[model samples]
Target chain A: MSLAPDEVRNIAHLARLAIGDEDVPAHADNLSRILELVDQMQQVDTKGVEPMAHPLEGGQRLRPDEVIEEDQREAFQKLAPQTEVGLYLVPKVIE
Target chain B: MFEHTVAELSRLLADGEVTSEALTREYLDRIERLDSRFNSFVTVTGEPALEAARAADAERRAGRAGPLTGIPMAHKDIFCTRGVRTACGSKMLDSFVSPYDAGVVERLQSAGMVMLGKLNMDEFAMGSSNETSFYGPVANPWDEKAIPGGSSGGSAAALAARLTPAATGTDTGGSIRQPAAMCGVTGIKPTYGRVSRWGMVAFASSLDQGGPMARTAEDCAILLGAMAGFDERDSTSVQREVPDYTVGLGQSLEGLRIGLPREYFAEGLDDAVARVIDEAVAEYKRLGAEIKEISLPNTHLAVPAYYVVAPAEASSNLSRFDGVRYGHRCEDPQDLEDLYKRSRGEGFGDEVKRRIMIGTYALSAGYFDAYYLKAQQIRRLIADDFARAFEEVDVIMGPTAPNVAFDRGEKKDDPVAMYLSDIYTLSVNLAGLPGMSVPAGFKGDRPVGLQIIGNYFDEGRLLNVAHQFQQATDWHTRAPENIA
Candidate 1:
């Protein structure tokens, strides 16, 4: 299916990405191609086939809830783009 | 010395013929002198490598040298290396030094392997050509104008150029195998869950698997021994005892049943590449193996299903890189939404953004059933295709890629054309089975790879099969002449 520029903008918005007006045509072209590529799935008859989430079909391995990790916030925050006093500093969401 | 395999370097160290420090220094010098042409490494940890080599030598003096002691290799930049930049070949993480080591790095480091440094890769392991790498595209050592197939291109290039004896590579749909084929090296992507994914940056979570890239199957076996194991940290990591991959190296392929899927040999395969693969199969037959023509009817659908599934997971995983906590940040964002959108917009490349948007669209309301669920159903068919093929044969044999490495920038603009490059290798990842590419022969000056696919957790058997082939042929030993 061909994607309109507005549809492409909607997707970028939903994906939290910013596509410039000039880049929309390129995004529309590539995304449409990819969709076209994956559209081959429509030819296959998957009647009654369950969605395969895992390659091995094994369920997620579980462990008891416990503290397996130490508090390394300071060490981890060292790479943060903006952190202040052990807290990540992001743009305010509310006034 | 630079051309020596990992196993050879280990032997040299064991025989007291050379010190680890000397070997490391020799490799460092080569990287310093020659790597400029290939652009294989993003960071060369010369000082740390020398320090580790000295420590390895001291261990030898204390009679505690391990089998892998003093052997030097590189980690694909995708694997987090504590205190070192694990850029994953993107400008996003170019300045981010991981505070913790990836599971693969921890294992290799504990095995007494001296790390040369982090190798370059396609940004976030997204592209087929390594051109997506913010550091720059890695040059195929065979021909400077050609690409080393990616997203593990840097790892393959380093091994082919003899800049490093071995390197760690993660294959989420042929990243390990394709690059190995293009660069004339050997690489294996173990069954999904056979290797821990913890600390290895996520691509397609279900498809991503870490494996070894080396000069020979034997070296890959040795490194695989260290790299594969159940890690509790990775919820998806299988709980299974690791096998000694080398123990089966000398086993005869006499009675081995090799399957050639009819679908793999259909259209799109280059004539020259198919001819080499046919020769490799003939070699296996000569080694007492039997070949069967089987059908993986859903093979045509694999690339499409993969494009859907991989991107879906990648979109979710990459959402973690919103510029606040770490990685690339946009300067002076107007507000939270702007921070989220612009940081991601500026940080990611076109391929990555395209995938994220596609994934988001597929997963969005009203489209989920048509796209994501439909893709998953096709995924089952693809996996079942492999399952049936495996039942008829011990392993599947085919060309690692449709063609040899194309010239750099040839398909850089065409996303679909680039995606087709991994068609042969993608299904294995889809099935979460073990796969490897061994040096089969050359197409002109470029190498063609013989892809070997094994059933789940049958990595040792696959390595043994590759080992038998290497023993019979000198193809894997043929190094790039300029580097050699």
Candidate 2:
């Protein structure tokens, strides 16, 4: 039930996080303790128990798919770390 | 000026006894002078606050003022305030200025409440002790070395220090109530959808709720009235009429059914905290409430279940912060993956990263069913326990935290011990019930709070119950004597 250092590293990669080598042991130890805590779920007989995703016991209200507002791309993009001509710029994804 | 409740200040402003400009100046001065010791305010908007106050005065002269008109309130940095940096206490957002107001901020502004400024919080509302802030930890005003329970520590600490008469806070797991408990203030987290979450940054969306924090339940009511309502922008916003939370303040507690959950009073609760809570119950009994012993058997599962569900949701919600759009970006990235990985790694703190990794692992291949699904099932069981208890008792009562505030750095190195700080308060988030902490009494110099739990949309009754209790005790009025 405990996560090994490699397993922890794998999870971090999946999460798109870079854990320093010096920090991995502590992360591994803490994550393992938490997993041990999560293991307590095995004792409960949750047969057919519904997985409650939200506290509200109702379905999400859907709105009609129509343009109902003005565009604010420029305003929104102002907070981006790098942007050009109203487009968000990231490190080049394709060579 | 700082000592008066929001209601009292409103009355003075309405009666022409105090000018909004004068009142705002006094509080701003207090914050400037005392906040260094408190560390409660992350950003203090003096010029805008004074400007807003003058506008309020003009509104009053023009006969256009409302109850909260001219009142100065602190906002937890989680809510987006247009033209201000809403950091959410994380370096990732250190440079991000919001373009729009959060739903709560917009409503409160329209009601004429002026913003004192944004208060600090645990980074991304992820930690309990407020130690994870990119801004340093907020000191408990009661005892400087003591920790103010968080992630709404700034809001609660400010209230305790009287830096702001009214403040806004969010609760996901025990963020609102735990700090209120530790700092001797009143805070209420209404039913999940009672308040709009549109612009309040998401952290475990299902459990996160924005609410009011202040010196008294009545102040909480006045703030909550303006804060809670349905919004078209928040998909989960309930289609229900927002009640006037103030109207129910004088209701009689006679024949009120109070449930004392057996599991809550069991092992692990601090002896002094339990004694303080018992004294509050005795006062409630004196007020003619009938108490019965009840149990939420799945209560033990709440901590583990919340750790799983919240982190999983946070991992998904926080993915939007990946270097490209808003927030921090890494320097000289060689590749896209490196950009994202380094930005996130350097941007988030230790606790936040730990949760993200755990959540990523829990939802990863070969583990989703065993962790995420299982935790959700436990969530259902926890909610069922509350539902069954509510069918019998009108309201539930317990200690808000296992103990009063611990020293800063005492449990910081021990994450599991730190996580247990919210043991008594997390179940309410799990069930989406309305819960609050009212100043009950003192365990020595530090304050202890009585946690009041009510069923869904029971915010009015919860405030009324606390209001009744406050009328009988002066605990909420008790400030940090050691500070001054």
Candidate 3:
């Protein structure tokens, strides 16, 4: 149930987070403890039990396909880190 | 004036004893003078609040005013406030001013409540104590050395200190109730989807619910009525009509079935808190409530299950903050991966990063079934436990937290220890049942809350139960010393 430093690094990378080398051991320790705590769930026999996702027992409410929201692109993009005329500016993914 | 409840303030405003503008100014001044000690408010919107108050006064002059009109209240920093910074107590959103209002904020504004400001909370509503906040921890009003239970710590502290007559809080696993208990205020986490989640920053979508934090259940009733309702924008919003929560305040608790969960009282519960809860239960019995000892056998599993489910959802929800659209961005990135990593790494605090990592690990390939699915199955069992209990009792009662507020930094380093504080309250969220924390009595100077859990969408009954208790006891009236 213990997470190694490499495993902790893998988790941070998978989560798209950067952890310092010194912090990795602590992260590994903490995550391991948390996993140990969550391991208690393993003791319960949940045979034939359905996994509950949403709290309410129903499908999501469907609305008409018609668009209702007014375009707030400029307003929304105002808070963005970087944006062109319309498109968000991010680091180049392709040459 | 500072000590008046929202209900009392509403009465005062209606009777011309106080003007909304004056009340707004007084609260703004109090927050300005007193909030330094408690670190309750993250932002105080004084000018806009006064303008809103004047507008409320005008509406009153025009004979168009509601019960909550002109009443000033703060929002937990989690709610998106238009043109105001809605930090969610995160460094990531430190500079992110929201473009629109949350559904709760919109509805409350429509009800004519003046906006005081945004209150501090655990960063992204992640921590049990407010210490996780980027704005620094909120101090309990009663004992400054003790922690105000969070992630709605600021809201509770502000209410207890009388900085605001009313405030809004969101609870995803005891955020509102625990803090309310610690600070000796009243707060309710209505049933899942009872209040709209639209524009409220998502931590755990299924369990996250917004409710009122005020000095009394009567005040909470007034606030909750305004906050709850079906919103077309929130797909999960219930289609049911929001009940007039104030109507049943005077309802007798005669013949009420109150179930005491044996699991909640067993080991780990503080003796003084148990005594306070016992005294409160005895009062309920005196008021004609039939107390029955019941068992929610799966209660011990709530924390472990929640640690899995909440963080899992939080990871997915927080993925939107990739530094491309909004939130904090790194200074200079060599590449996209670097941008995402450094921006997130530098932006989020330790607890948040730990959760995101845990969530990432849980939802990762080869582990989903073992972690996430297993937790969800345990979730069903916990919910079933409540379902069985509800069949036997009208409402379940317990201590809101294992113990009263502890010293600041006491459990900060130990996440597991901090998680255990919410053992009694998290199951209600897992069950999607309405729950509330009412000031029962004090443990030393710290307050103990008697938690009342009701059937799904039965907020009115929960309010009535808390209201009846408040009517009988003076605990809700006891304010922290030096707050005045």
Candidate 4:
């Protein structure tokens, strides 16, 4: 369950967090310890247990699927850090 | 002067003994004088509160207003309030003034409840203690050196210290009940979907439920009436009609079956806390409630399962906090990747980052089935345990925390120990049932809480039981004398 330095760095990248070089060792150690604990779950017998997606039963308890308000994308987009022509701007993946 | 419960304040406000302006100013001054020591509030809305008080007075003059009208209360910083800075105790939302009110805020405001301010909490509602808050740890009003159990610690502390009559709190795991227990107040986490999470900042969506924190169960019932509803905006909002929460406050507990979960009362429970809880249960027996020894066999897995599932959901929920959104962003970045990384890194606190990392790891491609899927399965077993136990008993009883509030630095270094602090309370959230904590008795100088959990949509019954306890005991009315 030990996460190597490089693996920790990769996790930091995927999580979009900046980890200082010194902080990495501690983060890796802490994460390693946590994973060790989480790994204990595998030992428990959960063969026939059904997965619980929602705590409440009766199939998601969803509200009526009706439009309550008009679209406000333009107004909401105004709060974004970077946007152009109603679309959010992000680092270019293609190019 | 500051010891009035919401019920007492309502009577005074109704009888013209206290003006809304006077009541609002009294609590505001108390918060001003004492909050620096406790760090209970992140943002104190003085002007708006005064304005609301004046309007409430005008409503009273016009001969229209309810018991809660003009009564001041605080909200956990998680709820988004229109024109107010609603930072969920994180630097990520340091400057985020919400444009719209959360459903709970709007509903309570419509009830004419004056806003005292926003209380501090764990960032994104992630921690068992309030130390994770960017604003700083909330001091337990009983002992300033001790920690206030959280992420509803501020509301609990403030209410316990008489800063606000009652406040709104969202419980994802132990957030509401744990703090109420630690701070010697009464609070309830209503049945899931009973209160809308529409504009409340998301943590673990399925588990996050907003309810009320107050000094007494009756006061909590009044606040619950204002906060509970079915909102069309929130996809999971229940469609059931709201009930008058205070209707059954005085209901007799005769023939009520109180279940004592063997797992909850087993090892790791502190002797002092067990004694206090047993004393409270004994009182219920004397009140004619039948006590039963029921078993929730899967209780031991609650903490492990919650740690995995909560963080997994949090990892997905917190992805919205990248640089290209409203919240904190880095000053400058070499590239877009740097922007996303540095912005998120500098914004979230250590505990939040730790949860995000744990969540990311569990949800990763190779580990999803082993960690995330397995945790979900364990969650079902835990809920099923409660379901079976509830079928045999009307309510479940236990100690809210393993022990009373510890010193601030006691569990700071050990996250697992802090996580274990929530063991008895997390199963209720995982089951999506109504649960409450009422002041039972004292352990040494600190007060202890007896947890009362009810089945789904059984909030009225839970409050009635809590009210019945408060009626026989005056523990809920006692306040810490030296708050500063």
**Best model per lDDT:** 3
User: Candidate 2: where is the Cα deviation over 4 Å?
Assistant: B482-484
Docking class of 3: high
lDDT of 1: 0.92
Q: Write the per-residue lDDT of candidate 3 for residues B90-168, one digit (tens) a residue.
A: 9999999999999999999999999999999999999888999999999999999999999999999999999998899
Fnat, model 1, is 0.93
| DockQ for every prediction shown | 0.88, 0.85, 0.89, 0.57
Q: For residues B26-116, what per-residue lDDT tens digits would candidate 4 score against the true structure? A: 8999999989989999999999999999999999999999988999999999999988888899999988888789999999999999998
Query: Against the true structure, whose DockQ is highest?
Result: 3
* Evaluation by lDDT, superior candidate among 1 and 3: 3
The clash count for each model shown is: 0, 0, 0, 0
Candidate 2 lDDT over residue span B1-484, tens digit each? 6778999999999999999899889888888889898789999999999999999999999999999999999899999999998999999999989999999999999999989999999999988888999999999998988888899999999999888889999999999999999999999999999999999999899999999999999999999999989999999998899889999999999999999999899999999999999999999999999999998999999988988999999999988889888898989998989999999998999999988888888899898999999999999999999999999999999999989999999988888898888898998998999999999988888889899999999999999999999999999988897545
Q: Provide the DockQ value for model 2.
A: 0.85
Candidate 1 chain B, which ten residues in sequence have the lowest lDDT sum? Answer: B475-484
Per-model interface RMSD values are 0.9, 0.9, 0.8, 2.2
The positional error of residue B219 in candidate 1, measured at the CA in angstroms, is 0.5
Scored by lDDT, model 4 comes in at 0.89
Q: What is the Cα-based lDDT of residue B197 in candidate 4?
A: 94
Over A1-95, each residue of candidate 2 has an lDDT whose tens digit, in order, gives 77789998999999999889999899989999988887888889899999999888777788899999899888888888888877778778877
Query: Would you list the clashing residue pairs of candidate 3?
Result: none
Task: Tell me the tens digit of each residue's lDDT in model 3 across A1-95.
Answer: 99888899899999999889989888888899999999999999998999999789898878889979899999999999999989999888899
